[model samples]
Target: MARGEELYITVPSMFRCPISLDVMKSPVSLSTGVTYDRSSIQQWLDSGHDTCPATNQPLLSKDYVPNLTLHRLINTWSHSSAASSSMHPLPPEITSGEIRQLVSGISRRPDAAGVDELEKIVRFASYCEENRRFIANLHDSIEVILRILIRDNERVEFLESAVRLLDLILLENGVRERIQRLIFKSDHEKCFDSFLSILKNGKLSSKVQSTRILELIASTNDSRQRTIGEKIEATLPVLVHLMRTETDKHLMEAILSCLISLSTSRSIKVQLVHLKLVPILSRILSDPETASPTAERAIKTLHLLSTVAEGRTAIAEDSGCAVAVLDKLMKVQRKAKEEGVALLWSMCCGHGDARVRERVGKENGVTKMLVVMQSEGDDRIVRRMCGDLVKVLRGIAMAESSSSYGQGGLGSLETKTTHIKPY
Candidate 1:
């Protein structure tokens, strides 16, 4: 056992539970003569197993007797203060019976009782990582919690406690894999629906958890990504609403990440633009207080949005949005610069908006920024994009100048040549 910086003690292997692999607080002996933690052996027995877990031998009797000798030794050894000045205090021990009782209560009762059980589970799990692992390892724990989320979703208090508990236990790999499996199953439609409901109506923390859970599922693989993308019509609006109403930076970041992951299909992209995702993202980028990481994600999502015609058109039509994209050219992050260049290139060149090109060139001074970025030795691709943007802007300038001269608006039409080296 190790606690803090001042204490270290190697717990004897015999004092650990074979099933949980944690220190045994209550040791018991099965019929096969192997001593185990009372809670671990009791859980095994309650699960309807008749054989010894360690030896897999037929049990002469299913009942286990307490091994008082081992318990006493563990108690004495654990209380020794001579080994170190200070040891990390252990959290209050929770028995397997208590876990089973709570889980059973949650499954059988779907009222205030269920909510109370969930709160108890959350409190116990929150006490320490060991308790979390213990509860997560118990069969049907995560399933029961998910069922509560799906069944009692209309109950705000129940949903809040259940979602909070789910978030806490989601740190376990087994729990996450189980959630992924449930999400992929065809019959589990209500499971995903429950998350959407939470996003729309639950408290802010619950909404954040639901968004993060969806983000995790969406990021797993192509199949999961496609599954989530299919729900874009239902999911996108709620996310946009949250982004518009919520000021919490963390939640905003989560929503942005979820957006980036789910914006995979062309139809989805079109819907995102229609849902005003472009302007929401634009507003995020326009804020001076947005963190660097959040800014990068917002830019990346906008870049994705810019892939479609509607997205590009919206961006080009909003001059503040256009200026924001241009401003990214001066950011210190290489990725921001790269994505910013690509986004602008798409809006100006891909969209073929002469006004945007002129505005970016004449008003935003993108020409000077691009020139400096190139001169400072950016990567080859960024330099190439910079070159392309410069050429496009210069072409637009010449076209406008020639148009003015042909209309007889200017006093003199003088041609000047300036050379820029190719990237």
Candidate 2:
């Protein structure tokens, strides 16, 4: 008999994952192949934890020798049962004693864990990633976990790690939106007392609590389809509040990312600009004395302002969206540079109506384009766009010059101030 065989066995019975109380399958191996999960099991065996579950005897991860004998017995027993069941009439219900024994057997397995409690937990996490409906409402699980962590017990330190793991669980469809609404009261005013209390006193880390706030206010459920106007109307207040008071970049980043979703609709774009968010943003980006890392992020938010066609037209009408962008263009590279060039191109090329060109000319837009064109931003696209702007400027200049040099040669002062009406 093996010396340490007793230690290898489950104290009272068999074992299982709290999740998927069934025997674990496709045990994932980590990079070291030591830990197990679905994705990396084979790698785990390759890294080598060879030992039989029964006797602690040397066994490969793939085929621990003990299971072979167990498998043969199960196959023979199953074959005999099948033959008997096929040939005989069905039996009556089992006696109470037999039922109790069956129930007892299932309960005793370490894997059973009093029922599939751990299995279901693990399974739901699996469902989130698979987009399967494992749980009736998985976001509820996130909330439950948060509230548990908020009590500031042993799990407080693990709150962030739990969230990251939940993110890996990816609830698709409008699950994101559903959960957001679920967390809040139907009447926003009604729930403020409770939510604010948590905000003020919860022991969950700031990042975690802040994450919940952003999730409720700004994050989209995978299944939602809100126009920018809808999102602005729905979340603008919460976002505005956070923008005023929250400084954590990640929480701010989540809010900003949600705001980016609003940049798609012209109605939403005009409304936000009209609300005066632009000036606040501009101050953030160009505050030389108060420059911060987020200044670079504020620079990137230029994309949101420039993306809307109507918004660009509004900029031409003096929204300051363009000026804000041109300011950022001074410090562009990688993605920031890419967005600047694209926004500039949109401002110049995507606009309709000659009034935009007239406005551009009036705003010293020629000088701005000329400077960008002269600098390293001289990508062929920028140069061509600048060339176009200059043509507009030159055309305006030429028209003035021609009026000054009227048909009467040098022209009289009164006649030189001529008006040429369009036909």
Candidate 3:
């Protein structure tokens, strides 16, 4: 249409992907079901601009991220180059057969018990960012070193170096998960005690490094493998200390969830109550937005706490604990009905106190819980538990109804009505 139109060169089909050049790797799926290299194609599709480049037809299905080794290779190379400028780089890959090489390569002379070997081992652990085969080996190496550091007979000074190295290892996000998964069957207290010492260092910056420590400590799977006594005796104080000192949400979640899981311990239950964590938990329940998904983790932790005898005693001591957990049940009714229904169902644990029932019922918690209970027509467990919760609620309502009758029957009946009429 314009004088310059003929000057525009046509793009060649060879430039397109030979497999499907119309769109360059929308998902880039491999035969192994791994999808890779998204953005360029995904954004093109998301922009509502999909059409076959060669045929001019609408785009079809898109693919998911794939599990191909080449994809991992590409991602690894890209991140490695980018991470060169950082203090810590790529995280270690979880590998199976490299444990022996990792162990031997990092071993010190039998007499090298000084902090010098500790320093070299720590540095090797941190280089996991480079993520070569060495990266995997380094992770395995950390386990062996951790054993040496956590051994009760080891000099405490080298244990201190393990703390610093642990922080560097967690600089990568997935490292926390890897550590959480790996620390399951180890002498965790030694590691935790080491971390606590680092935390207590007066010279350490409380802002950034504290949060990383909290995350790893929180996600560590110590509970999954350790005895309940071991978990409380070894881990709770350290995590409690983290909760008391750290303010970042990720860290708070890790500490809180860990604490919640450990609430079975009479000691930690006493400590949380002694520290007045109930009001804090209550405030979080009232406003899940402070932590978003972390808030959800907190709520689940609270639910777990509610199941323990020590937890119950703690709740009894702090009225706010029951109030907070039930408050979520109330919120589920008014603001998030779907989630609320689930809470009520779970909370119908065959029993609750009068004060809790009253507070929750006054907050309109009963109506939602009743609806869920009424719908479980054939669930015997639900039926038994719901009946108990309903009894509690009805008793509260009857007590109110009788008091109202004493005050003024008809008018009170109108005001306290619980029935809903359908239009």
Candidate 4:
């Protein structure tokens, strides 16, 4: 493992927090005799839960007794010859005053040195998970980055660092809620327009970071859908453009992830279908080279889109959609399997035509359904749904066969499936 500038042999298991599964920097003992990181335990308790998250037992006291000895041991291990070579020690824990000073420095002069300090602060906070937790709710730091973004003569270097830092701050729930309100609560649509503009015209790194923040804002847990709806409408076209034009695998995954989150809402799903995203997603899913997260999010997005009538018809009319989904069944991750099957079921459900059924049978759709049912027995819903799909496919095949026999020729079943355009 690598720590900051040092190469380490290994991290001991005892140094890990049971709740977060991350290395504990500030070990603390709980009343239940289990030791945990102070922040992790404090957050767990702060959420109004009395039982331990790692062990469901109720706590006798909600106090976090600091384990000073273990803390010292971790400090020694961190500073010891785990460093293959001598390097600068880890930066001290950043204070609120120091952060304020850094922000002030940048505000005074948005030059190279100011940007350097900004990037340096961001880099230090990323050194360990604890640092990220510490900086997660830094509203002042976020405001400084925002100032950098809106400043005249915006430096690409500064913009990138500022956006990266903003992304890190939004990881905390309280920061997300506050930022959401600050941007969207006052009916200031231009603030959102800036995000779309950056996404369309910013540098590569800035574009990625812009998309990340836009995704967080769109996915905020607000009861008011009007703001989210507006954001989606403004951003959908740019998201489609990015998905098609981006060649970087990781960037594409992030874009698709945003799509998945946005498409979960019924209103946004309609806009996506109208924009004709079905075929693009289907082609991506069929490609063997697509990364797993991208494929999973694509398939899930398609599943949500299929819930609407336009979505189902769009998916079915495309020649590759059903075949693409079937190709991935029982071949990808578990959730992908479920999504693929669900989409196929939606496509074939109301299509009572002979040609569509025969096409499905010829495409090996029925055979794939059977294989998925067998492989996914542990999931009762998948098993039941796959069985129902096979039944429907067989019924279509039987009707097609009977019609062919009545015409007294096996060649009668060779009719091509017609694609009907949805109104």
Q: Whose lDDT is greatest here?
A: 1
Give the per-residue lDDT of model 4 (tens digit) for 1-423: 455454545667777788655567568998887899775676446434566656657677898788888877776766766531332236546665676667667656644346657767776564545566666655455555565555555555665676766765555557766666666644443445656666777777667667767766667664654655765678998888887777665567667767765765677888888887988887787789875556767788888898887887787677777777777775566667888887776666644434345566656565567777767757888777777677678655555556656543323333322121111
Ranked by TM-score, the better of candidates 1 and 2 is: 1
In model 3, state the lDDT of residue 391.
53
Question: lDDT, candidate 1, residue 311?
Answer: 89
How many clashes (backbone N, Cα, C below 3 Å) per candidate? 0, 18, 8, 0
Better of 2 and 4 by TM-score: 4
Could you tell me the TM-score of candidate 1? 0.68
lDDT of 3 by residue, 142-215 (tens): 55545554555554456566555655444343655556654555554455554455445522333224334544
Per-model TM-score, in order, reads 0.68, 0.41, 0.53, 0.65
Using lDDT as the yardstick, the better of models 1 and 2 is 1
Ranking by lDDT: 1, 4, 3, 2
CA error at residue 103 for candidate 4, angstroms: 3.2
Stretches of candidate 3 above 4 Å error? 1-106, 110-140, 151-189, 199-234, 260-277, 307-310, 330-352, 371-380, 395-423
| CA lDDT scores, all candidates in order | 0.70, 0.43, 0.47, 0.66
Cα lDDT tens digits for candidate 1, 139-194: 87877877776673367766777777787677665887888777666645466777
**Over the stretch 1-423, how does candidate 2's per-residue lDDT look in tens digits?**
444332222211122212223222223322322323332222223322243222333343363222333334323432354422432112324433443343344335422222233223433343222323333244344444333233323232233333433443333356455445544433332223333333344333334344444444444443343522242354555554665666655455445554555455566666666665656665555445423224444545556776665556555665454555556665543345446656555666665445545544445454555566666443676567555655555454444445666534324422432331111
Candidate 3 clashes between residue pairs 3 or more apart in a chain or in different chains: 17-21, 34-66, 34-67, 35-65, 35-66, 89-129, 90-129, 332-340
Model 4 TM-score relative to the real fold: 0.65
